[model samples]
Target: MPLNEEEAVLLGAAWQRLAGGGPEAAAVGAELLDRWNEPHRRYHTLLHLWETLRAVDVLQGEAADADGVRYAVWFHDAVYEGRPGRDEEESAELAARLLELVGEEPARIGEVVRLVGVTATHRPEEWDADGKVVSDADLSVLAGPTDEYLAYTAAIRAEYRHIPDRVFRAGRSRVLRSLLDGPHVFHTAFGRAHWEARARVNMLAELDRLASSAPLDLPPP
Candidate 1:
């Protein structure tokens, strides 16, 4: 869904803050909107961005660098082209350049870039409280109700329409298995308490469905 008026206002405010509250902020915000609103996007559209920013707001109390986390959330998927590590690498680099253009301090820009890159692994260092906060928020969707989780999976499938079904399912199952095998799917205490159990339940159910599906045929060697 497109953002409501209030959410749009809040997004503008965030951009203004990050871009040093100059006239250039509007231009930067428009550019971001264009990128995220690209027609080919399904799940990583503005709806996801707004949801993530809302999550950041709800969890900022736990962040060591709340502004950095917010900026990271906006830029993390900014360059998403369905290429995992490359998407993150490009997003982080673009975020650093944009923040620098806004005359942000080098340290602050570095922190934002670092936070954006951390989403690639979704594993933050022990001392990276801000990273933990953003990571948990970014993954908060996994904890949603079953219907929403189903919808999310469907949206993801839509995003990767180019991939054949068998290939996509196998790749998706592997990703789910990785999440299931993790010590904790969510890093923060709040995320652990609120999202961990539900995410596991959702993942396990999806994993079972995936496993039960017939395997793709292979040609004789």
Candidate 2:
């Protein structure tokens, strides 16, 4: 489903706050909402966009260019197709094109594109405050409560339902293990203090379940 009226109003306000209120900004925001509401998306839907934006708000003070990070959040998964690197790249491209149409400053647009690309790896240099904020916000879903985390995984699996069970399981395991191997699953101090441990627990639990299960037989959402 698309964002509800209140949610749409909030998102429009956010876009206008960054890009300014005008016909171009309105059109760009509407197009992005449509992209988020694309039928093929499962986990990477409007809900994820809203959650990531909220997380950015929580970590806003940590960013040198919080508006840039918010712009990145609006485009990070805008082109998600279950393909990792390519998706981020295309999303960044789309951000650049649309942001230009709305007359966003070139430097800010470049920063937004770079921030969107950071989500592909979820790794930013320790000194990159804006990048760190964007990465943390995009990954906050990993630290969700148990039921929400499981629902996230289910939605993800549903998104990639075309992949064979064994293939998907192996890929998902690698992704989880990489996160677990990191010193901290989240980049910001708030994330480390509040979300890191819970994210680890959630990922570890999912890893264990994936290890023991033959295949996830999830119903359509």
On lDDT, the candidate that comes out on top is 2
Q: In model 1, where do residues sit more than 4 Å from their true spots?
A: 17-20, 214-221
TM-scores, all models, native as reference: 0.92, 0.96
Error of 2 at 19 (Å): 1.6
- Compute the lDDT for candidate 2: 0.91
Candidate 1 has an lDDT of: 0.84
lDDT, residue 198, candidate 2: 94
Report backbone clashes per prediction. Answer: 0, 0
Error of 1 at 206 (Å): 1.4
Looking at model 2, residue 35 earns an lDDT score of 91
- TM-score for candidate 2, residues paired by index: 0.96
lDDT (CA) for every model shown?
A: 0.84, 0.91
Clashing residue pairs found in predicted model 2: none
Model 2 stretches astray by more than 4 angstroms = 1-4
